[model samples]
Target: MNVAPVTPPRPLDVAAVFPQLVPLARTATRLHPRPGAPTWYDSSIGGPLLWPADEPWPHCEGPHEVDGMNPVLSPADVRLERRIRAASHGREMTPQEQKTLERIRPPRKLPMRPAVQPYDGSMAMLPVAQLYARDVPDLRAPKGTDLLQVLWCPFDHPIMPRTALFWRSAATVTDILGTPPEPPAMQFDAYLPEPCLLHPEQITEYPDHLELSTELQEQLSQWSVPQADEEDMDPQTYYDCVLSNAPGWKVGGWAAWDSTDPCPRPCPECGTGMEVLLTIATFEEGDDEGRSWSPYENPAAEPSPGSDHFDPGRPTAVQIGRGHRQHLYICPAAPEHPHLELMT
Candidate 1:
């Protein structure tokens, strides 16, 4: 079993400092996804899914953005390049390796694969995550469903890969797909997520001030910073970054609203307010690894050998829109309702 760290106490008692904010508290499950071999049975990020063999694999019929410049590269091509890129760290790339990269840079006619169930032009979606309700504490599902599988078209749906959601009963998936189909070509390398097992940690959170009412926002802005050293800094900034949202992959939490101001994200099927189902994050924590939302680990424990030396916060190797987050929002009233997607 993979070892998961425990999140230490918050820098200050937010509730005690601001009693009125008590009602705003929401529980979020921080899915600390780390590099590991996760099977279909596991709740994981970028791991092989528990997809049924008989059912057709999901594909994004993107009305996809076609920028005539960069050639769409196959999943294998991107994976090969990532491997080379990772190996080249701390050392110069070999002449052959450099040449290989240069060759793949240009657009070339990709050979078609043997028809897998007579494929149409729609690109095969990449597996983004698979969450078993048992593993993720906050993953509520529709009736008779306990598993959630997420997939995304490897091409950009404007800014990021468009996601599709599926929820099913684990017991019903008798014949699991041994190998799933891959997109013939993907637009960006970051769209593909490296397999990582999850360590879901539940924590309480409040909404970013941007999501609060005007009166509350004004009140929060005037409140004093709880930390003595941070007194000079803006109180709203301190609360938003430190006291509010817990970073990394999480479920059922408030939106940070960092990229754009908070906006209406109502479910299309039924105009109900949507709830955060899953948050696919870029970095695990804030500026200081040991501070803010980062977990506190045993100081004497030695670093494990053979761990991927990629971005420490990015064990999954998935970078969303220049190190931001992508959230999947489901209807709280009816989870089966069409979900909402946002990048922040």
Candidate 2:
């Protein structure tokens, strides 16, 4: 079913070269999400959650500001558009398909639904991910919890969509929700994720060199990749891109804070430090993103450039601000404490 290898291939034994990095190793679950029709019981991205039917669906009470860039469209419209695009790829659309397209996106008008009022109303949240602890070995859930459900408002709260976290006992959810509520209209179509099944692979990760101690950072700068081609790259740059925090969808690993690498995200309620719970990323890695970071066992299976097919790199099709990452941090002191969201 396209599950990724647990031990992803790496060019160099990083820890062998950098002995000091051994103790810094932290296990992270790489959720290699590939497009599939996932059911409620499956651990998936943009899939149905194993939610109790009686529980009220979460909604975002927002004062949403619509930038001209976002053209509001209903979830149904988005799905239809996707289907039309896929069906017509590399071929001319049938007359009926063209008519259906026009019905969804009529000339000189925007797609909208009468019931949507996100400008000053509560909008039902869309499922971002649903992870069962059994599927993700690195999922550090609360004592009574075995499932983690993530949902997000389709409208941008600041620059990125706001997300909510829910932890529950899978056994307690006796009756599954037949159909959860969807927002009448969403600001951006990218907010609607393509359903993807997870191939959770546990891997070790170290903090970004920028997030390391000054001494460790200094030490790293002196060690470049032994490879002939990468020898030209700076030592720290190689480590940061190839050996440090992995990219794409993952749980409980170092966050790629890039320019905003303060790294000390303390809990708002308690003084205890926060930990990264999830990272919703735009693109999965390829050879271009460094061989070490990519989870693909076969290089040829990677998405080819200029192809009119589904790009595996963007299987979920969820993009944060300007193609950045949306990281959710939970309080280490108490999982129930309000989670924090950051875009980087």
Candidate 3:
């Protein structure tokens, strides 16, 4: 089912407050994905991609160690656990409930030796996300290409889930490969994304606080606020409400560099600066109301009573350090040039 576009919250007019920021706006498209199966031509997460039959499918050759155990739980077990938790909210679990809980979440066995072991060469790469230029206007594929496909190994590299990028023309793919190889095992459930269609919504964005110069920072801090009849507003609050970094998954928006200083990665093949192609985020919105970039047409609409915790940002079921975003950058000069991934 097609959902309505999310209405982006009105950001504070920083340019009007600080004239220097007028030229800093950039367009971003939020690709909202939900859980379902997708076709080759559709924009989806963890879905079959349009590819030539002759092209070799990508796979991860690991000496891969089982980074962690990801227990597969049945939906019935999940429902039962939820019921037990809901019923026992304010009271201790009854003996029967305790036994059921124990059975639901059995103790996991620890590896006999050091967990670091070589990959047995059985893991296969899985499709992560696919986007067509027709769906996302901001997708920066090569001159002749109209599609971007991302695949990653299920296990983590030293840098965590390593990904590969492919750019191609949808028109050129006359023979689509029907069956793709699947990963034998996944280290975490978060690594597996339920297929979702994209409801791409375009919006304008500004640079994060760290990107601002010291003078601009001071100006932001010292700007005089118009006094309301009752109270005065803090300039810092204005900045936070308007000028702070945009959170969650986005395309062509400013990078959320909360963990460290800005590290501009250069293209290995060419000297051109790489641009952010996509940001895989953990949550759609944080506690800050200003960062609520929901694409729903009506922002005030409430979710179903029991589904209030539904998070749009985690649609892909992918997470980085402490739920930080994984930023993928591409060379501006050449779209097919090797891409870079950074988790912040």
TM-score of each: 0.87, 0.88, 0.79
Most TM-score-accurate candidate: 2
Q: What CA root-mean-square deviation does each model show from the true structure?
A: 5.1, 4.2, 5.4
Give the higher-lDDT candidate: 2 or 3.
Answer: 2
Ranked by lDDT from best down, the candidates are: 2, 1, 3
RMSD of candidate 3 to the truth, in angstroms, is: 5.4
lDDT of each: 0.78, 0.79, 0.69
lDDT (Cα, tens digit) per residue for candidate 3, span 1-344: 43555745654566777777778777888776654457887998767899789898998887566643444344345446656775676799999998997887667776644445454766667787899988887787788888888888867776568888988888999988888777765655466655565667777677776678899888777663542111244445545434544566677777876667787689999878988898887766643443445555533243223321224556555667677778899888987888888887
Off by over 4 Å in 3: 1-3, 68-106, 110-115, 224-245, 287-291, 298-313
List ranges where model 2 is wrong by over 4 Å: 1-7, 102-118, 225-236, 286-289, 298-309
As a TM-score, model 2 comes out at 0.88
Residue-by-residue lDDT tens digits, candidate 1, 45-89: 888999989999998786665444465567787777777776787
The global Cα lDDT (0 to 1) of model 3 is 0.69
Clashing pairs in 3: 5-295, 5-296, 5-297, 6-295, 6-296, 7-295, 7-296, 63-118, 63-119, 64-119
State in Å the error of residue 170, model 3: 0.7
* Candidates in descending TM-score order: 2, 1, 3
Model 3 weakest lDDT span, ten residues long: 300-309
Query: Residue 160 error for model 2, in Å?
Result: 0.8
| lDDT comparison, 1 vs 2, better candidate | 2
